[model samples]
Target: MKVKYWTCHSDGCAANVHIDKNDHFIKSHGQHHHIPEPEQIELRNLKGKVKERVITETSSITKIYEEELARSNLSSTALTLAFTAAEG
Candidate 1:
C-alpha cells in the first residue's frame, strides 16, 4: 500500500510525526502521499519511519507556545485598546 509521512511543525516533539497509507493518511497522524516503488519499498518505509522520529522531537514547541500565551494574558480586546490608546 502507498504510505505518507508528516513532520510536526513544532520544534520540541521527539517523535512528532505520523504516517499511514495514502487512503488512511489522517489515521497515521502524519502526512499523506502515495508510495511509488515496488523495488524501493524499503527505502520509502524508512523515510516514513524517520519522519515519525523527527515529529516527536518537534512537538514540544507547541507546549511552549501554549504556556507563553497563557502567561501573557493579553486578550484581543486588550491589545486593540492598547493600540487605540497609543494612536491617540
Candidate 2:
C-alpha cells in the first residue's frame, strides 16, 4: 500500500504529516498547529536547509513506525492471515 505525507516549510518545525489517500489528515509531529495559508506555504526544491528538514522528518517517520510496530501485538503470520481474510 502507498502512504501519502505532507512536509511543511517552517523554521524549528519538523512537522511530517501523514495523510490518508484521500488527503484526510491522519497525524503529525512538532505541534498540533494549524496549517499555513497557501501563499505562506513555501514551495521549493530540496536543497541545503530544506534538505536537512526532509531528512529529519524521514527519520522521525521511521522511528514512529518502529514504535507502533513494537506496541502492536500482531505478528507477520497474523498480518498475513488478516490480509487473506480481508481479501476473501
Q: What lDDT, from 0 to 1, does candidate 2 have?
A: 0.51
lDDT of 2 by residue, 2-84 (tens): 56987765655677888888888888766625666432221121122334554667656445444433544554654454345
In model 2, residue pairs whose N, Cα or C atoms come closer than 3 Å (at least 3 residues apart or on different chains), thus clashing, are: none
36-70 per-residue lDDT for model 1 (tens digits): 33323433443445455557666564454344334
The candidate 1 region of ten consecutive residues with least summed lDDT is: 35-44
Instruction: Point out where model 1 deviates above 4 Å.
Output: 1-38, 58-88
Q: Which lDDT value does model 2 have at 77?
A: 58
TM-scores vs. true structure, each candidate: 0.23, 0.33
Instruction: Give residue 38's lDDT in candidate 2 (0 to 100).
Output: 36
In angstroms, the error of model 2 at 85 is: 56
Deviation in angstroms for 64 in model 1? 23
